[model samples]
Target: MRDLAELDDRVTHCAACPRLVEWRERVAVEKRAAFRDETYWGRPVPGFGPPDAAIAIVGLAPAAHGANRTGRMFTGDRSGDVLYQALHDVGLASQPRSLRIGDGLSLRGTRITAPVRCAPPANKPTPGERDTCRPWLARELLLLRSTVRVVLVLGGFGWQAVLPVLGAAAWRVPSPRPKFGHAARATLPATDGGPDLHLLGCYHVSQQNTFTGRLTPAMLREVLEEAKHLAALA
Candidate 1:
């Protein structure tokens, strides 16, 4: 637990990617109209939830005006509205919505994180940038490994990013990596006698998916419930 806190502190101070550093700071300064009076977190965001979480959710990156502004993963974002509601419905979350940091929203037996801690421009991180930010994700997974049984990836980006990290942590990768798609599932056996890992895929809860019916509350809830069941948190 102490190690996780230290990791979070380190993540918050990272300036590894010059483009991400400049862009995040720029967005923080040029406040959005709705948040004109509010202060932006601007720094890299860290994973949120208990250290002993059984389920770990991997997202692509912090939303520029969402986690980037609020300093909490998925908070103050439309994606969060869709995600937290499903989690709540499935009994994995304390509330149905995540607004700001300290909004009393909490996860039960689950943690939410991202491969890229910093908010990327256009809500997309380049391949190089994703690789550069991977060490943090790798370390975080290590810290959570003892209890983590299910890894729920939000999109293809997260699916790709997390697989390598899992491999580095000694979780057995399949001969041919599984493809990413909504409701996809892959079981990763342990190489070091640890618990086997269950990897589940779900479409990102971004506005593009949710607003277009590509991902619905029912769909999201199904995935979350499956994750909960697999993690033995149901």
Candidate 2:
């Protein structure tokens, strides 16, 4: 795609994976008890934020009832609750909540996206599905390469998924490849002589992590602050 607008438009219409298409659509129709009266997006979700973002937040995939219901990444979900609040606390978000599309929520110099565009069954996308969706992320990072200086990856799945995309974007991933861990850090040099990219890892803000006290708001904010510093946004 020539631009992020076109990329996002294309993403919403993607049906490349039959399984992902079926699962996302089925969940929309079945409707969770609480959201039965509301309409579900049941479509692929695109990255969120401005085109000139200096920082990117990568998550695993859209949640079945969360982004699937609201048609926006991290919207209407507990995971989003923790994430957006942390961004706001760190002065990167316009507001602390991501309720739905057009909620007036905005990220300053940051974009949030996932490796998988379509929400998968049981929150898991097969290896094939992740590979099939790789081009989208690759193109997105390429489009943002001029401005994106830092990538804050949430969880190991996103960490693993993004490394290859970074390489594809001309960022030289290390030979051994950096392992994933909370607060993990890696600096990837652009083979094309572009600005270097900084990668930061943090535990996902999923309910499992937040509820268990594994990923506190403070911890999340710390990472965001660090990303801002790395991106020169602070």
Candidate 3:
């Protein structure tokens, strides 16, 4: 892809994984009861934010009723509620709520994306599906290689998924791959002699975590603050 826009267009058309393609489409047609009257953007969800983002937030996949319905990563969901609120509190987001696309929500110098663009059944994508979707994330990181300096990965699935893509995008991922943990940090040196990239880990903003106090709004904001500092946007 020549740019993020082109990449995004291609991503939306992707049907590389049969299982994912079927599931996302089926959910779109069936329609959740609360959203029956609304149109579901059953197509693959693309990353959101500017092309030259200084920081990137990576998540596992589109939620079946969230991004799948809104066609924007992390939108229209409880997880998005917590995540965006934290971003707003840290001054990275223009608003605390991401109800849907065109809701006037904006990220200052951050972009949000996912490893799996399609919503998987039960919110779990198989290993094959994750690998099948790797090229898209790899291409996205490559496109943002010039500007993005910090990657805030939510949960272990995204952490694992992004590390390989980072390597492919010219960052030298460390040997004995870094383990995922809330607040974990790793610095990856650019193989092509570019600026070093900082990787920050945070617990996902899923309801399970937020409701159980496993991930608090304060904790999420702290990570965003750290990302801003690392990206020099603070």
Which numbered prediction scores highest in lDDT against the true structure? 2
TM-score of each: 0.98, 0.99, 0.98
Q: Where is model 1 poorest over a 10-residue stretch in terms of lDDT?
A: 1-10
Q: Indicate the worst ten consecutive residues by lDDT in candidate 2.
A: 166-175
Residues 1-234, candidate 1: write the lDDT tens digits.
Answer: 357889998999999999999999999999799999999999999999998999999999999999999999999888988898888889999999888888888899999999999999999999999999999999999998899999999999999999999998959989799899999999999998988999999999999999999999999999998999999997
Candidate 1, residue 224: Cα displacement in angstroms equals: 0.5
In the range 51-71, model 3's lDDT, one tens digit per residue, is 999999999999999999999
Clash count, candidate 3:
0
lDDT of 1: 0.94
Ranking by lDDT: 2, 1, 3
Q: Give me candidate 3's TM-score against the actual structure.
A: 0.98
Better of 1 and 2 by TM-score: 2
Q: What is the TM-score ranking, best to worst?
A: 2, 3, 1
What is the clash count of model 1? 0
- lDDT score, candidate 3: 0.93
